[model samples]
Target chain A: MKPFPAVLKEKKRYVIFEIISEKRVKEDAVKKAFFREIKSFIGINGMADAAPTVVYFDEKSKKGVLKVDNRALKQVEQALSLIREISFNKCFVHIIKTTGTVKKAKELVKRGD
Target chain B: MKAFIDFVASEDCVSFGKKLGFSRLLFNELSRDKISKTKINIISPKSPEESKRQLRNKMIDIILDPFDKRGLFIDSAFLNIAKQKQISIGISFSKFLRADENSRIRLLHNMRRLTALVSKLKGDLVLMSLAAEIYEMRSPEQLILFGEMLGLSRAQATWCITESPKGIIRRKSL
Candidate 1:
């Protein structure tokens, strides 16, 4: 099997966001809530376009890195911004920054500590 | 760098707004004699008629949200008057963020209408957190993104957080 060429491949973006919540949210709960909101907002087809994944998340820092399709970056952001709560606890997810690489996104998240 | 201004519902989010990088945070309290000692004045009228009355008052830096208590009262006439008065039409992000799924749909419908009219009239539309709690406070970029979601162009959305609010602050001088 051969992978697609760079031009044919979907360009990716890393979004670093911090969840400001009253209590520490488990990574699983965060992932669940995140995908649910994205799916609900953008729908299945849009989710496929986004191709989002939680690449890294720190429970203590409440910061996480999400990998998504570059073209659907704004759609992912809209979903994250509209997230008012997760696991029944009120919270707000603020995008610290978006970068082209996961390493850079992780570094930005680490610097927030 | 553009100075970002946000309007908050209570005194609690003031410290949080500072942490979020907002240069100014207007505390919207009806009974406040001078807005806040440090913050600018903001008014949220209960009805379109009341909004018309508040537009005459020079003390108000921004007409926080033009809603008739339970419903939005924004129309071309209201926006034109607001434009003439130099009073920025504020759209609080928390209002939509706080609504349930059913009401959120209705709210979005109304907000889109407001956005189209404001853009058509070239009115000053200020987007604020108006967060009652610390967690409710969103970053300036997030507010700008939310503005874009509300049927505003990217540049127009950026203006809501940057130039629009700055104009109100400059006029009020606080």
Candidate 2:
């Protein structure tokens, strides 16, 4: 049998944001603001072709997948689901930054959103 | 007199769909509890696995069609047996809820496939306990992604923080 080459992996990067609001209604608005921030400032240049982004939500923390070449997104979301964050109301979204180009992982991370 | 639907055969799904106003209701009577909500059942002479295999085979007959073969329109012909059904779709995490490393890796692949399928559908949001799941998704980001996949300009995608069972105002993401 031909040996399978180890899949290329990329270094991970994260984008964080906080929109201050005393109002509960502002929570949704703030999240939208953050998405706009990422897309306009970072998502377009870094993740134009990206889909299947897995966004995780917990009590005040969030995670999402921006882009990845061969990264498994569903497992990330399911793994997040296994988290017992049912305790915390606020949450996070974790995005797998995959270009499947491990060679460019650092460069991609450095180009901040 | 208020016009109502009557079942000449039985009070099964086609009748229920007429009553409920949805042309079809997504359901899989995998168990008795799943059927309890709907008040109907489809008993097969074959065992569950055998029946599932048979059903899958029948589905593949249609799924293999060159033009009409989008997996989104999966065949749940027998799924119509339940009454008062509200599309009881399950997101199984049995694989991901594991401690072994290899299994965890496998679970991720399943999730990626799931994400892609749901993201691709982009329409057909399920009305859930608290909110409308645009494409079987549970996260705000996916709601946005599905919205955009359906070509919602960036501004049209909106995510409400609270999970409310009250009927959602927007059927699809803006």
Candidate 3:
């Protein structure tokens, strides 16, 4: 198959979220919970299509940006919202903003911190 | 602009919520003595009868978790009474947070049913974080998203998080 043109590429969204917990959260645990929650919410097929990825995470600030297909935005948001515990500590994921570009999402995270 | 309110279990959470951008805070326990000192008070009834009694009293600002135990506590008849008395019904997101997988699904289904009922009756519905700690608090947008997932429209969800709580605060002051 020919390489798809840039215009034909799948549209993506970046979600900026912060983890507020009693203990600092590690990136690996965030990734684990992220996939687990998304899988549980939408199942394996949906996970394959959603193709969510943790593009950026700062353990010190406990802020991160996730890249997901535009079609899966709601599913990803719902999954993130439903996450109550991470690494045995009660936590809350507060989604700050969603943008089409990574730059804008990163800016929002910086301003939030 | 919108004002956010959370019904908290502990007195210590009041100030913590204030720091987290909550304009107003309500304590969930029903001690008349403590009510006077707090920003707001929520009357958590033990049974349907107690809920009915509290709804009639103008002093009682909110009916928190009326249907948490089991079965339908707020039926159409009770909703009409609440509407006539200008009383608001509250649903706590904390319950959903603490529920396990099976229970979470059931809770969501119940919430959707209750939200539909409240909308049909034109009764006031408030969505509270009911956070006991700072970490448990949710942003306004997150609350609205949660509301939407439970079958409420975006505008309705926004109202639950903003206008409904404001109305409760207004009535409390008046």
Top-scoring candidate (TM-score)? 1
Off by over 4 Å in 2: A1-113, B1-31, B37-101, B111-139, B142-174
Per residue, candidate 3 scores C-alpha lDDT tens digits across A1-113 of 99999989999999998888889889999999998888988889999889999999989889999999999898789888888888888888888778999998888777765
| Candidate 1 ranges with C-alpha deviation above 4 Å | A110-113, B30-41, B52-60, B67-72
What C-alpha lDDT values do all the predictions have?
A: 0.82, 0.29, 0.81
lDDT (tens digit, per residue) of candidate 2 on B100-135: 444544444433443344335431122111111111
Give the clashing pairs for model 1: none
> Which lDDT tens digits does candidate 1 get at residues A1-113?
99999899879999988899989999999999999989977899999889999999999999999999999999899989889888999998978888998888888888883
Compute each candidate's TM-score over C-alphas: 0.88, 0.25, 0.86
Local accuracy of candidate 1 as per-residue lDDT tens digits, B20-106: 888878777645355543556677777777877877776666776576326677677877877887877778888888887677777
| Count: clashes, candidate 1 | 0
Q: What's the lDDT for residue B46 in model 3?
A: 72
Q: Candidate 3: where are CA atoms >4 Å away?
A: A1-8, A107-113, B15-20, B28-40, B68-70
Q: Is model 3 an incorrect, acceptable, medium or high docking prediction?
A: medium
The deviation in Å at residue B11 for candidate 2 is 29
DockQ of each: 0.78, 0.05, 0.72
How do the residues B1-174 of candidate 3 rate in per-residue lDDT, one tens digit apiece? 677766776677788777667787776764655555334566667777878777777666667767653755778998898888877878888778878877777777778888889999999888988876666677767778788887889899888877888887776663
TM-score of chain A of 1: 0.93
Q: Ten residues in a row with the worst lDDT in model 1 chain B? A: B30-39
